[model samples]
Target: MAPSSQSSLAAKPLSEFSFPSPEVTASPYPFYEAMRAEAPVYKYPDRNDYLLARREDILFVFQHPEIFSNLTYLADPAQAGRVLASKPPGSVLLTNSVLSQSDPPEHAVKRRALRGLINPRYIHSCEQSLRRIANELIDGFIHRGEVELRSEFADKLAVLTICELAGFPPEDRDIFLSWHRIGTGHGARFLTPEQRALQGKDGPEQQAYIEKTIAARVKEPRDDFITEVIQDQIARDGELNLPYLTGTLRQILTAGNETTSRLLTTVMKLLIEHPDQLAKVVANRDLVPGAIDEALRFEAPTQWTSRLVMADTEIGGVQIPKGAFVFMLYGSANRDETWTDPDRFDIERPAVRELNMAFGGGIHRCLGSPIALAEGRLGLEIMLDRLKNPRFAPGCEDERENIDNFQKRVPKALHILFDAQ
Candidate 1:
């Protein structure tokens, strides 16, 4: 037979399992293991939603956006309003900038506008600047012999990179990063007490800063991505579509920074856990990208996404009503039986890169994935080059539970003592 259908913890029973439960957030693999077998199309007892626990089922949902719409992300007012309420009024535009939120013709237009700017080729062209930014952050504590790797270096690398690519003034990077923490709903639990206090304070300033930048680009275009994008948008619309541009820029900056940081942190953490694998990658840099991709598959940062059911649908033998929410568990699907060793953290896994839902799949896939991967790979390469024999500090080897949320796995603090050279 295949692996046992019952997880050792299955005694708790599937009905009692509350997702986003602090318990499940801390140790999700076992729970996922049972759900895939026992309840592949599990229904939420508390809400009118369904969670697709199996890989094939989730991929089916991803592929059929006609029946399972991305419109739930922002197009549906009830859902969008619920989400928009949490965000600052300054971020109204941030609600619907990503093309992934829509399907078909409009998605194509949005893709054309922003795809070229954030694509892998464009991101690679900025590698020199990225390298300089990585070295600059490392230079801050490389001589100190120890560093809190996640916050000190990883987060800043992601932030500075987004600032570089978006043409934001480098000095305002702190402002944007601060505002971003509050903007991404999954990020609130990861913030410091000080960061929590600064939440509402930075939104207005960040809004004003973006507005100022937009005006500058409109009046006199500069030799930058933002400027070129603004020129194209104005030509297409005849007048500035302020909300659209604002949302697109914020989405690009938000997703790029947040996802890349989490992925980079996870990549580093996995390497620490498997020294043999880490040695392989460190000795051979070609394995860097594969290592990052494997980390994404092993532990996806953003976990589940809720999609609106456009029409009544049946998935994995379970019937879901139209307009109900279907939560596609990217984390669970990634760990399902699709891989030979479903739970193993193997960087050299052949089927992972093309198939993993770490960045989601099909048309609604993450737009900034190329940038996130590039950043993670380059960020890891930079760290391994500088921080020799990096290992966790005693008693601090494990970080806190994943930010008290089911939606994303954010490793906010991970301190390590490194032989910094």
Candidate 2:
């Protein structure tokens, strides 16, 4: 039988709950259980947003985008204004051209343009390059016998692969990675004023870099995704301009690398902590794909995303007025009691059903999911083959650090030790 609702946690009032608190952000499962049972549609105090924790509510929100709009630029104009203020003058940093923040018609067009670049066939063909990149990353640290996987291997591999695919110069990989970190950190709610200010400077730097890259690609197109985007613009009589192209490129470069790096770190951490699963994966390389899926389900990278209510609606017996924001907790929904042993990190779980909401659903589902999965599977396969008897470095098994952000759940560091092969 399914476990009873956590009645003990139902006593706490919603006003007392904080979404981005350090305690909750570090380990939100307990809070999620409480919210799922006590208040599926929870309103944040002093805010116009609601938190939807139950799986059913989240699914409903995903399916009914007409009611819950993804046009975040329109939904939150103040925030968009602030973001635009950080960019160059006349920049459309928060414009609908960005696939993630756009709505229908505009979203459809932008999604189609990007789909042609990152389609499944393109991702599949990049597997050999991904594997080569993964091996090269491992080669850097194999002789050291101990390495911090996050910075040494995972981060570099993710950024390098994205740079190669985006037609960026190889030497600019670290610069792009730094921009991603700064951009992500700047947007985080839990960051300090100093940190935010430091990160804020990178916004225009990233824009300037992308702008220059787009200009160069337009004049000298190459056999890369950026070239494809440029050709599409020419074919459409220049319907897509520099700002729109840069906005799309920004999303691709950051999201493509950030989420995949987090996945690589999390999956490796899970395997090291669960030796039984690790042994199975090491013995049989074919298990890596299943293991990746299970890891995504167990610890999603992008934890929560919000939608704007286009009309007054009731969800989970609670009335949400029009214009209220609904935050779908993907991390919580993935661990809902609906799944068999939902909390267990079992690689052998049946793959017949949709195991998790990691990549989201509906039309706005992640565009780079195929590439992320391929990169993750190939990275792990190479690691398992090259790293002999890998395990966490001494006293480092419990030193995992997750960024204190409501939207993203990424490990900051993961140290591991293995025999040099």
Candidate 3:
């Protein structure tokens, strides 16, 4: 994230740029800015893929799922099979059933099966629990006066909030955290089989536990998403698809935490860097929602998402071949010309009719967005309420690092200090 990173990128040819250049993860905004202007539909040099940076181009791809597929695995089964062949059994079992990875008819059925996730009544009902979870997380760190907000607060709060929604036990937090770490960290593809085996060692126990929960729900229904999905699937398909549930649960357990946790962490970092904005939010708690939106725009948590080009097509005048993976740079698109001074982190920015594409768009737009927003708003509000005059912990500016992911912007550490009551 040094100043030279920007200059280095400026000096390079658009063709010379790599998909995941060394400095992209550390200082992505500058890279995103350049890509948006120069290489809006960049063909990544490393592979048969494209990086879509402009808001217009990304929106076009989002709107046309038929032309550009979300089911990357099905679209290119050869690649999918090769990758899954190396992945751990747990991942191999769960990757395909991911709802966002599919299109129409299939996507519709799965989406409808899990509609309770976005049900207004369910969200409204969970507000109290979400608030309570946020406060409980604050309670753990408020008395300490100094705490690592990433682990103690943001990550824990996100997991617990998802736990509340999924009807997963709060006691299983360590499990969720560990799984998320392995899933999002270096990834299973890079790890050796021995390493992957070590990581997925608990697969049987985890599966058994989930099966037990599903059986319990089958007998005595609950209000949680797991129960909602189970009943709806049975009603639609006349039988339960354990593989479907397994994949959905895997997505819920990991994807649910990654984006939201990173959002909470990044938002906290942004506010601390701009205390004036933090003070404004502190004064007008109503601005909490706006702050979350601005954070989504300014520093999107999930930075890159990929869609398969279903057929040869032109986006921003660039020809993308069939089966080419188009990487939608959400970070870049969110900062596209759509906003005046898109780089500035302004909570006061006028609310736009088309908000940023941080959670994606179309039918495949993030289903967990309502929960993530609610969790973020309530968590930040509680932090402001409980931790007065929060600021960064001293002497760790260079030590803080983002997760080793091009797609996610989560930091490994977010140390902060606050005045205790």
Candidate whose lDDT is highest: 2
Instruction: State TM-scores per candidate.
Output: 0.88, 0.90, 0.87
Number of residue pairs clashing in candidate 2, backbone atoms closer than 3 angstroms, sequence gap of 3 or more or interchain: 0
lDDT of 1 by residue, 1-421 (tens): 1343222434566666666576787867767766875888988776778888887898898788888876664545876776455432432233444455656656766778876667667788999999999999999999998888778888889888888887877887777666636324323433456656766566666566777888888888888778877787777666577766766676676677877888888788888989999999989999998899899988899877777788898998899998788888888888776666667788888867887888888776787777887788889999999999988778874573465455667665778788868
Which candidate order results from sorting by TM-score in descending order? 2, 1, 3
- List per-prediction Cα lDDT, in the order shown: 0.75, 0.77, 0.75
**302-345 per-residue lDDT for model 3 (tens digits):** 77677778889998888888878888888887777777766678
RMSD of each: 4.7, 3.8, 5.3
Regarding lDDT, does 2 or 3 come out ahead?
Answer: 2
What tens digits encode model 2's per-residue C-alpha lDDT throughout 1-421? 3554333433465456676687676777778877776777888777888888877888889788889887655555886676445433342233534677766755676788887657777777877877888888888889999889888888889888887677677798878767736334213444557657776778899899999998888777788888898678556543446766787888888888878888999999999889999999988888898899999988888887788889999998899999888888888887776666676788877761264789888888888887887888888888888888888777764458676555667676888888998
Q: For candidate 1, give the lDDT of residue 417.
A: 82
lDDT of 1 at 70: 66
Clashing pairs in 2: none
